[model samples]
Target chain A: MMETTTSLSFTEDGFEAFAAGREEPQWLSDLRNAAWKKFSELPWPARNDEEWIRTDIRQFKLDRYSLALEPLTSEATATALMRDGVELGGGCTSFDGRKVDSFLKDKWAEKGVVFGSFGDVIRSHGDLIQPYLLRRAVNPNYDKFAALHTAFMTGGTILYIPRGIVVDEPFHALSTLSNGSADFGHTLVILEDGAEATMLSETASEDVDGGGLHCGAIELVLNPGAHLRYVNLQNWGSNVWHFAHQKAVVDRDASLQWTIAAMGAKVAKVNQHVGLIGEGANCQVNGVMFTEGKQHLSYHTLQHHEAPNCRSDFLYKAGLQDKSRTVWRGMIKVDPIAQRTDGYQRNDNLLLSAAARADSIPGLEIEADDVRCTHGSTSGRVDDELIFYAQCRGYTRKEAIQMIVTGFFQKVFDRISIESVREALGLAIARRVREYE
Target chain B: MIDTLVIRDLHVSVEGKPILRGVTLTMNRGETHAMMGPNGSGKSTLGLAIMGHPNYEVTEGSIELNGEDLVEMSPDQRARAGMFLAFQRPIAIPGVKLADFLRHATTNVRRPDRKEGEELIPMRDFRKELKGNMEQLQMDVEFARRYVNDGFSGGEMKRAEILQLAMLQPKFAILDETDSGLDADAVRLASESIAEIGREKMGLLIITHHDKLLVHNPPEFTHVMLGGRLVETGGIELANELHSEGYDRIRKAYPEADAQNQAMLEKEDAQPVG
Candidate 1:
């Protein structure tokens, strides 16, 4: 058994020691200190807060989890889901917020593609990454969780694509957390003008039912005419408490296809935002969430049209079984100058059990006169007739319910361009379905 | 060994309303039967009850297939017992492809003892078989890729149902209004396809209003339902008589049953349209 490292708990001494031990650049250390100070000043989100009203975290004791000062090995590590049968340009794997393995193809590296752990890359290429690190996309002071993540963020993946370089193969990253530990991973991806890349990232636990805490951030900064397909699957253990702040900013003539699947977590609150910062920028986001047991997952998404003639489409589908619940709040905000913007947002929830619940709230705030913006939300139980129809065709009640639940999410899955991701998610959900009847 | 489905004075109700009062019928493999009835006469209810629909409560009597009581089984178990029902108004499964749905059904029915999550039939063989069935039904192969009955035209839905009937090839099959809402050419095609795929291969209980479907697969037995009971039983000639002439004569001859059928029809009309 690994010994507990409580000395790295949230404190001024701990923060200083953590930064000094990393031997990072002085500028990065100063940035962490500033974030640490901000984290100390910020207050915990109250129950009455708008975002926290539906997701209760009062029972979450932060002191129960501490940072691991030394590498902790485990017997059972979760196999990577997205990497199965996938040809990749590079891959990175981390355990308990410690980088253990990383590899990149020399062909891409020769063409000026940088892919590896964030800690090593940030230290070696600080001058190249300094402009976009915690600056453009994700706001570190948005909440206490975001501030803490910025302050203590450890092992993560970083991908830097030089100007006019487009790599066809995808890069995979996996983060695994052990019991009673914490993961404060930060992902940063920077693409220059006319460059393109695909990033597949996932998080899991050594034990399927283990307990831990994960406070993370992801920032995607796309320069002019850049294209990106970013897929992230959050499969933390059921006992984990997860909080993340992820954002992307698309520049002139750039496009982004972001697909996210959330299947695990005891209590999760995630903020996903996309900013159309330049003219002719476009984005399409597909979200699939399936929860069982007593998991509570809350997601808040924002499609901000900051420039004219931009388009954004967001669709989120969720399936809830057992006593689990999901809350999805989406907004399509069009700026006054963003005329000719075409924005659409939709959320559909399928309730597999009577005790399960879902809260779907969709909104739009458009100041552009010529923009066409629409949003719709639907929440309902699986129709008994659909189940009966399948049952009459020789499917057992359990298999019938499983097929129907899978069909419910097929619309969002169709939007995913990666075959391995789609297969992995489909199998993962099938394994979790029980006899809802 | 055993190839028979016998219904002994079966009584079924929807909610608290009685639909099938006392239906008794016996069918064997390699035989075709026609069940003719007017609207609200409980023809569909008998098929539903036979399939063990949860809403259709079988208060009394039993449905036996091959010496086994099916009333004690779930719908899926009944399906595995080689009994099939083609609904009048099939439900839509939005994101489920018809090919995938039929593949699973065929696998489960073929291997009744197979556990869940077990391997399905080989895809190459399944694909070739599904293609052949689709072609025989005069359907485009693209139809298999579409969602099951979602956004399908009335005619397309019926053809899809026939495709499933062809694929499953159950020992006993109930087709409810398999010819309704179809054009003459489509009806003729469906009739020919059903005769080719099912005639003399399985026991068929075809419930339809028109005789177009019967032209190709003539029933050996014809039963007329009124007041939730089979008031008349005859041969193929009886079907031709009912097709050429309406049920007015039969209704006039059976006054008590006529009165009950009128009462049920009136009650059905009183309910609101969806």
Candidate 2:
């Protein structure tokens, strides 16, 4: 273990006592010990760091918040998360990093789909999920925040789809924070060879008056010939500071689709990466975000091609108003052995107010000779003629801009395969846009 | 109150450069008038100004639709008060479906007379009406699925504008240079559709330079404009005279101003709308 200098609230003693109280397994306890040392040794990302060059978080002080020990869920939170009327094979929910409840539909449970809290899943099906836990996809030491998350993870949710099983509906998970507190939750998903499944995870906070902190991680592992559809919807309150590290690994001939909607939070930072690790694997990543009222949101993503004949595509679109700002940095990386890899990435930002700003940085790092990689980014207000045309149709000025903004995001919306939740997410972003007026 | 639209002593400018000067016109229900002028003679300016385009400032005029002053209202409000302007060159807005745009427009404009709690037309009924109208305008139903005027040909954009005119069915319609880029056959087809939609109820101000469309659906009166002002008014013979004589007589008549109108028109026709 590495040595550390500064003393923080979540120290070695605090983690050891919490792990002992929770009766964590030996492997988890060891993982936390190592992660805590790493977290303590590593310093917070500074403005000079390349990954954080565009986003300045100097005002955020970690000592101002304390970790929440118990679930803080309510009936209203559950009802709101399921209001989109999406069909789900299973659902699990957590509040303030603590598991409140989880269940699988009878048919899916009979078909060997396991979805339960971390503690329960480790005790019941640890052997089945052990190999994919931290072995391949996402490592806790990827960054400082990632390491901190591993040290504090408690009652996160786990989902496993056995080989050859196909779930007809998506699985849902929601995490809610009740007040000013710190919550660190981890999510792991495993799909065996030839299996197919989709998961939709959401994080939301109701109270915006009190400041909060959320550091989270998600890991997805797909075996050969598997298909996984994953989506994350984040709508934290305006007073929340959210940081997340999410990554996925796809094996030979596997297909993956991941969509992220970052529609809330006053200050947020997320790093998402995916690796096409085997021949003929394919992956698509799409993201949409809306910000207003002095909110600052930053996103970093990577598409790693590790094997030959892999294809990866990414698109991110954002709409900003008021004094809100956003930063999107993405990279397409191809390994030396990965030849004939096809990669594409694009970002589009629409600014509704003069004070709003958006920065899009797209990078390509290719060590192979025969690869196809392309990237593009654009930032501008909507075409004036568009507003004029909509106005000619009897729409008010506010209504006209709203329609133009919606149309600006139609290309991203067209890519969503989940039909039931499309309109719901669109309405949520529309609400954010309306707040500008 | 909705039977007439009056424009009195209208003077307008774009970016503070005078475009329309001291123009007056009136349109009553059942009347079809054509404001014919050469390029840059402010024919389209009148059409845009009456519809309250923000870029074109109405410096010295009042536009009243059924006794309600339109200069005090926004473009959408003027549209809600029953006025429409078919663009000379319709803009391309990607990802905006024509059908969806029309439904929202129809709802907002049609809501003024609607009873409280009365919903807009159901989707099924709206689609049926839209398809029927598309067929009438010689447009394939697939045009509704495409983005609004995005990647459309010149004739297609013109027809889409006409389709909007048909769908919205405003009280006073201004077709600004609708026949500029169409072939003879397409012009005749568009004219037939216009006559069908503007028959005896909607007052139409068909702003055009060519007499070809006028031959298909001749207006009851034709007003000639030059140097940003009305120069003359007559029957179809006036259009025939201008087309055959090439506006030289009007230039000779106004001498200083009408001649400049002819020169500006030539320069504008050389370089199309940006």
Candidate 3:
């Protein structure tokens, strides 16, 4: 069996123990084991590494955390815990590795769509899940976190849309971290050709008393001509440490848009990679992150064009206030074979206070002479002219600043194709802005 | 008697350079005041200062409205007190819907009791009102949905300023060089709109260099400004005199004194004010 490596020894051992006990297929076990060895041998990112230069990861003790196994006290208690520190809407399922609370599985399953926990998918649709299991679009050697997530991922959601299926509503899946316990979840999405859907996933901590850790992985595959929109809102408790690896592959003539809204976490790191492997593929990556109270968010993104005539656009905006900090490094790569490719990358930051800080680095690597690629990054305070204009229209200085920040983020919301999800995010962002006031 | 807008010995500066040196003007309810001057004659600076723009500082003198002090108030506060300024070059604000902005400004300036008596204008009513105003300005209905003043043509931008003035209904308005960029037909239409707005008890302070605006809608008092001072005050004929003889003649007349005092004497050939 093939096994993956992870940073934490206990997490690797626990997952290895699960595989051995279940007597899973040798190929799957070997994959996990190989992943575990890679996780142990890979050195932790240092300050000099270009990707991790602006983010410090020394404070995280990976070995001390292991996958959660104990059952929650009750379904009601688990539901309450998952609902805290985050917002969830229609057709939501909250799970704690043992029992599923408020599951709308049957209703969704009847519509020819599979919306359930990772364990359920493994039990019911093993054949459909086997081919994509542990198949990551993001390179495992990209960072230590990517290697770690491959070894210990246990539970998540698997969304499979059959051909020509279009779901008018958004389906939400939330994974809750038990108190004082570590969590490793996985999200697998396969949109068949001509399928259109939107999936929203939120990761939050169950315990408000102190910090915990959550490390998860997400993989998405879009067949030819499929459309998928994914939104991830990470509002872990202030004491939590979060590391996630998410990737998506768009096939010929397919399109995908991903929006990442990060608000809460003491220290967080995310690696998002998208590959347009087919001709005429399109993808847009938009994100807005707000950090305060000594929190730090580090984002690494890649837009890879491997086929001809593909387009990719990326915009990430961050707001740092009250001594908080953020780091964004994004790259657009065009291969020589990918002639006539169009790619753009932009990262803009707003510093609300003197103590807040942000670092943005946008780069482009083009191997095709016929391609058009441009990248830019800027970090600064709010525009005084915009603020003054708002004030002249009867808003106070504070009100004017808040309105500008809200308006700054509204651009991302405009790109969301789902109305209900957009509204939900709009309300959440408004509340966050008010909290600063 | 108290008037809608009263400026007394107004001294203003921009970037430490004096622009308005003790200029005085007043406009009562239902009255129109015309200010004529060549380029850089401090005509626009007076309008900006009177609107309490933060960039322009009043180093000396005072501005009042209906017996209340205006120099100490903020721009929005002055706006709420029934003052408006139609900018010569209106700024474009992107991502802000024009209709939403109009409603916000109107509701902000509305009296508290009156605001309570009426519901916030329904979207439909507001749209109809906006359509009417756009029709009056010869603008398409699509202009209302675009970002405020974003990508508007020269004439369209001026028409938008007037549309806002009509919707807001300020008691005193300072139209600074509103006719500078408009064509002859547009100037005639804008003049007619201003005259219609003036019939609603709104006092007008029209600033321009051309005599065409005054010919279309004559002013009750015409003031000539040169070197940051209101050097001459007379009836409407002063604008025609300056148009016929040109400002060089005024400069030659005041060669010994200051340029402002000389321009004042040149316009003094017309019917004099008390």
Candidate 4:
């Protein structure tokens, strides 16, 4: 077994060299330049910043890793990586800045849905990809990672659902990194009005034998009355550092639901922002994170109500066992004119061991006094009575606690409208809980 | 006769105020005992203390089941030791199916060898057993799939407890005001369940204030409790006497019993025990 060291760095030479070698669009090259400037100008998040108070990132050194321009094509390595995604019940496509693995095109392209490398989308469907790619749905000014992802993103997925088209099953795009590798994968989803689809973006590592870095971004746009369900299941094995920015813009009467399940990664930072931009727009954001074995998971969620009569609800639950730690900070902001806005935010956590810890910071900033706004945060252990009740029946203490925790997380699972995604999340959560126990 | 439950000089309290003081009772296998008392006479407290509820503290006493100490065990341990209590007010636990809970309790109390062998009840056998018990108690079959006592009416909750008693089949059972808050039909069904348990060689201790339950299943030993103490012990005829005269006669026959009762009353009024 090889020892891995996960690290990230900022260097203009590496960015420019990769861009020049790929012969990317000149406009994208300019965007990367602006992002690099922003990444350098912005200061590190401080303890006074309300969202970053409970999370300590002083130990995260970004100067230890260089950009990985090469792809791992070994048959054994690709075979091992594809096996991890097989359990998720979908065909997988793997990308390295140069070429895509054939498994994706041979199995996924026949469905009339585009599942390919970002470069392929630019080369084949430049007309369809021009207007919708990086259209500011995910602003690069939110945080340093957002800026970093925009500056160096190289490989990703481009999914375009034709009008009134429906995909009966899910297709997976798995982005992984090898030893001393750096990855920047971008996933762009555009669902025309009346289009229905389910897309899953899973990021993981082939193995944790050496240090690697994964910085990715996902942008989703749903037109009027379009329905889209996006699930990001990120379990980048240990000895990997991950940072991601995901944003979605929903139009009139359109519904977009985002479910994020985070299990691995030595240190993971995520920012998810959803904008309900039209009347009658509905958005639900549900996330479940399990942190164990000294893992650190930091999640920041924003429910921005920009349109009147729009509805948004966010529920984030985390379970911490072993000596792991997690921080969940969420804000529901109702703009001044966003009247009749219905929004709710709740963060509940279960600390299974004394050494494990969770911090929940839920807040509300409502400029409209007449709207309904509420936020709640709670962190505690499993209910003793519930546990005792289960134990008295025949289950051992471990089995009883596991069942209760699984049920505790079932509320989030209940919100999943897709049966396959719901089942996959349930099995994954159960497996993580058992591993921690 | 092998004693199934022996409670001697039991002094139980909640939050430093005594509820059951110097009360002694014993029930052997194949017998049933009825405890009749007025409100706040520590009847329910005695039942809860014997079952090892965490809220009720036994200040001084000993409860033994088949020569094994009961006070030293937890509520579940006591339950696993062949002792069961049908709560006057059952707590509702959501997301836990009634059938699942019953199967757990039954398998937990079974002998180790029986549990290890193929005799262990399968899911189908468990469902059939649950269905039979529900039918015997006149309960809806769908109730078995619902959460444990969640959103159940008062009558339905009591009947559910009896359903548990029928399925778990503990050696010694305590019915704490099981007949309270029930309609006539539900009362009759509950009493029938109690009588059926008594007929199965399972010792029973019934606590009640009215004679409605006694009308259906007559008790062998009738004890009248006043002020946390047993003032008199008689045959089933005592129930008839109390039914006719109300508890005032017991208060008149023992004047010091009344003052002692008053003291107990003031003690209870000062700090009420649940």
Which one is best on TM-score? 1
TM-score of chain B of 4: 0.91
Residue-level lDDT of model 2, residues A222-252, one tens digit each, is 8899999898888888888889898999999
Q: What is the TM-score of chain B alone in each candidate?
A: 0.96, 0.91, 0.87, 0.91
Docking class of 2: medium
Model 1 chain B TM at 0.96
Judged by DockQ, which candidate is best?
1
Model 4 TM: 0.81
Q: Write the per-residue lDDT of candidate 3 for residues B14-91, one digit (tens) a residue.
A: 666566788888888778888887655677778778777676899999898888998998776777787888877776
Off by over 4 Å in 2: A1-8, A70-83, A208-210, A435-437, B113-119, B259-274
Chain A superposition TM-score, candidate 4: 0.88
DockQ of 3: 0.20
Q: Any runs in candidate 1 off by more than 4 Å, and if so which?
A: A1-7, A73-76, B266-274
Per-residue lDDT of model 1, residues A1-437, tens digit only: 23545338777877878887888888888888888899999999988998999999999988777788875455338778888988999999888888988999999999989889988898768899988988999998898998899889898899999999999999999999887788889999999999999999999988889889999999999999999999999999999999999999999999999998999889999999999999999999999999999999999999999999999999999999989999999999999999999999999999999999999989889888999999999998988877788888999999988888888999999999889989999999999988965
Model 2 Cα shift for residue B146 (angstroms)? 1.2
Task: In candidate 2, list every pair of residues with a backbone clash.
Answer: none
Q: Please say which candidate is ahead in lDDT: 1 or 3.
A: 1
**lDDT for A243 (candidate 1):** 98
lDDT score, candidate 3, position B5: 75
Expressed between 0 and 1, the share of native interface contacts present in candidate 3 is 0.17
TM-score each candidate. 0.96, 0.95, 0.84, 0.81
Q: Write the per-residue lDDT of candidate 2 for residues B136-255, one digit (tens) a residue.
A: 887889889998888999999999988988888899998888898999899988888888987667998888878877776788888988878888888878888888988778877877
Displacement of residue B254 (Cα, Å) in model 4 is 8.4
Best by lDDT: 1
lDDT of 4 at A287: 90
Q: Summarize candidate 4's per-residue lDDT along A87-183 as a digit string, tens digits.
A: 3323445533334552344333454556567777777776777777767488877788878888877777777776766665665676666665667
lDDT of 3 by residue, A1-437 (tens): 01133222465456566665554455556666777778878888878988778778788886566554444454523322123333332344544433354354455467678767776766777778777776646455456666666665666788888888887566677766555456677888898898988878776666443467777778888989999988877766677788888889998999999888887778888888899999999999888788777889988898999999999989898877788899898989899999999999988887877788888878888899999898888787776555545444544455556656766666776777666656666555555553232
